[model samples]
Target chain A: MITVALPKGSLLKDTIRMLQGAGLDFSGFLDSSNRQLQIVESSGRAQGLLVRAQDVPVYVEYGQAQLGIVGYDVLYEKEPNVAQLADLGFGSCRFSVATKKDGPYRSALDLPPHCRVASKFVHSARRYFQSIDLPVEIIPLSGSVELGPITGMSEAIVDLVSTGRTLKENNLMELEVLFESTARLVAHPLSYRLNVDNLSEYVDLIRQQVLVVA
Target chain B: MITVALPKGSLLKDTIRMLQGAGLDFSGFLDSSNRQLQIVESSGRAQGLLVRAQDVPVYVEYGQAQLGIVGYDVLYEKEPNVAQLADLGFGSCRFSVATKKDGPYRSALDLPPHCRVASKFVHSARRYFQSIDLPVEIIPLSGSVELGPITGMSEAIVDLVSTGRTLKENNLMELEVLFESTARLVAHPLSYRLNVDNLSEYVDLIRQQVLVVA
Candidate 1:
């Protein structure tokens, strides 16, 4: 079976829609039972594996799943050597550097060397600060990164700001946008090599639907 | 107010029991409709911040929450460097290295250098392999780590296995245990310093309850 990894939660809804638009009807997956972690498509040619949004790329990169739908933020952080075949055009958000509304960091360079910043995306944060010639101490936080700047543990935070309400409510302001994020369809290099013709057809179907929406 | 970070899901039930045992009662918290993320205790001197289990340490480490209840698995994986003042003595589990029941690996040394192993605890996996003089490629996966060995993406997996049922169902067997895990009560270093007497008293209450259980 040609296995695909789908991220759970908010992205799952849009991902299912995208798959349906691509002529891959996997409605049986809507059973809402925890036992249905893996599902078979109507055609039985493809199978879907539900995983955390952050781990989608790892599944595809390791060839456990031939393809995966994942957020751009995770892609930037993991930097897995996989084929970024197509953009799924949903789950949009922004990767931003945020600080307390009253803090000194107005720009990226305003952050002093050795200052501590908290983020789940450690690699992306390191690369961003390195590009600005400042070595930062990154306190890797799994979640609740907004609490970092609010409580004085970090000088700034790099996190996904969806509606900006969370940041505003916490008295935080966006200093700079690191990247605009959206979900993308990624494929394994070996998968593409082994099933080039079939995978290309599947990609074409999804791309046609995306172009229609565009 | 003294803010405490309470882990969401099953752990929350055990935490509430522990707090009640400590003579702190907040019955209103049981109301499911209380969308209010923050809640005040009856005493009005303490408050609770509901957050993900993985995020409990993040809140406490930043001092947004002076204290937190989280699993030892998350604590070891994140390594937040906070003070673990008490082990609440519930939510017991262990981090185990598992492989297919019929795979070649019977011990850590049986795996080849540079062989890939999948795990949610990347830091733990790296440290364990490094200590054994084995260089490895750690495939960081957030969930369903057992699938790694099943799909041939990794030769073994390091994950929190409460019972061996999941591994057995996946045709896998435990090779070695990395750590024994349980729920822990963590506190921020600066928060403890700022309110030494109050925090120490709170810690003593939890420690006493844990001793009773142990």
Candidate 2:
């Protein structure tokens, strides 16, 4: 049986729909009453491991799951060794630098040297800062990064901005967008190369569905 | 105004109750309709910043919040530079090594050397294994770690066991416990040292309430 790692949050619904379009049904994960982390599809040809967005790549990389659906932001941050199969293209967002609306800094380069920037995506934040040749401290925060500026913990924050509502509500403004991110289908490198469990056929079906949606 | 960082999840209710006992009412956070991340108490003497359990210390460490409530397990893992004030004594649980119920391993030492152990508390896991002179690869997963052993990704998982319901439901058993943990009151070192915003008086009040309950 082919194991698919499905992310638990925002990307889940669309991911499941895409899989369904490809003749796989792991919709049991979407049931609020279903607390099972691992679920087998209706036909039992494939199983789904409902995991955190960050861990989706980990599962696929470790070969436990032959395929996974994850956000590009997570893949960029984690840099897990997995094959990029197809862009499912449903969840879309951007990694951007945000700061207090009334704060002095207007852009990434405007902040002073060694200014602290809080983020959950520390790896991406660090790389962005380094690319600009700016020296800054990236404080890793797990959640509610908008509080970073509100609480005066950092001069700015680097985080995923979906609707710009969160930033606006918190009195923060975007300084610069690092990149756009969308959900992507990924697979274990070895498994994909070996065509284990007819991996390519599943990938092809998912890709066709994505193309149909696009 | 004194800013207190309150954890968002499981610890929030009890922490709020404790604060209420100390004559501060930040129970606005408990109102399900309330979407505010930062809230001022009814009396306005203190305000609260609701954040993730792990980010509690970060808020306090940066002095954005002079005081915070977090789990001891988080403190043990993050090892942030903050003064541990008092044990709140609620939200108690233990960090333990667990494996599949039918697995060969019965204890931490029984597992083969270099076996992968998944955990959210990598710091504690590493320290525990190192102390026992056992070498294990610790896979850091963000959430749903029970899926680690279930998916054959790891030999064991080092996670917090509260009621043991999650483990039992997943057909896993505890191997060895690292330590017991409870909610703790923490303060920024500098804030506590300088007695900022009459911090000591508030700490004393909370400590008195803890003693009363104990």
Candidate 3:
């Protein structure tokens, strides 16, 4: 039997639904009260390991789970060793540069050199600044990165923006978008190469689901 | 009015209860229905900024909040510029090194050099390994460090151990404890030094409550 790692937050429901569409039964995890981190699908074809979105690639890379569904932002940030199977095109969002809405600066280049830029995605933020030849300090914050500018701890923040509702609520204004992000199917490279446990078959079905969504 | 940063999860209720003992009411945060990130105390003498546990120090360090309640592990890991006022003593836990219970290695020293050790508290782990003159590779994981060992991603994990229940459930055993962590009253250094917003009096009262708890 094959194992698949499913992220546990926003994209979980849709991911499980897509898998069900591909003939996998993971409805047990959809129950609100189900606290089980690992659940066997009713059909015994595969088991699902509910994990943090960021850890999805880690599981697949280590071969504990032959497949995983995670955000593209995470895939880019961690750069874990895994094969990108398909972009499911769900849970769409963008990685953005933002500042306090009232701030005088309106662009990434306007922020002063060595100024702080807080983000949970430190790697991605660092690369973005490096690509622009800007020298800004990237302060790593796990969550509530919006508070960076609010608290004056940083001049700006690089965080995921979806629906733009949260940025509006936090009094932040988007300056530049780093990239568009969407959930993608990822698989262990070796598992795919060797077609272990018919990994290719499941991946093809999931790929078809992605194309359907797109 | 003084601004305070209170963590928003498990320690929140107990922190508010302790503040009530000090005659400062932050019960608004205790109300599960309260969605406000920033809420004023009943007396209007202080306001609380509900934030992630790790971000509490950031708020305090930048003077967005003159006072904050957070775990010592965060203080040591982030190494923010804040004055450690008093140990709130609630929310006690420990920073520990662990591996799969059945692993051959029995201690930190037993793990081979260059072996991967995963942790969210990367700074603390690095310092601990350095102090011991070990040069192991430390992989930063945001959460679920236990999965590091189980999935063969890392040989061991350094993480917060609250009840040891979760670690036990994961089939991991603690090899060594780096330090015991507890919630602490941390203050913005300049705020306390200048006694801004009558910070001294409030800290003294909160300190008294800690004494009572002990």
Chain B structural similarity (TM-score) per candidate: 0.93, 0.98, 0.97
Best-fitting candidate, scored by DockQ? 2
**lDDT digits (tens) for residues A1-214 of candidate 1:** 6788888877888888888899886656556764566778878878888888888888888778888888888899989878898887889999999899988778978888898898989999999998888899998876777767755678999989889998988889999998899989899998787874388778778888788878
Q: What range of 10 consecutive residues in model 2 chain A has the weakest lDDT sum?
A: A146-155
TM-score of 1: 0.85
Q: lDDT, candidate 2, residue A2?
A: 97
Interface RMSD of each: 2.6, 1.0, 2.4
Q: Could you tell me every candidate's TM-score relative to the true structure?
A: 0.85, 0.98, 0.89
Pick by DockQ: 1 or 3, better one: 1
Clashes of 1: 0
Minimum summed lDDT over a 10-residue window in model 3 chain A is located at A142-151
On residues A17-119, what C-alpha lDDT tens digit does candidate 3 reach at each position?
Answer: 8999888978788888986778888889898888889888878887889999999999989999999988898999999999989898889999999999999
lDDT on C-alpha atoms for all candidate structures: 0.83, 0.93, 0.89
Off by over 4 Å in 3: A42-45, A110-115, B42-44, B102-116, B130-135, B152-155
Model 3 gets an lDDT of: 0.89
- Ranking of candidates on TM-score, top first: 2, 3, 1
- Pairwise lDDT winner, candidates 1 and 2: 2
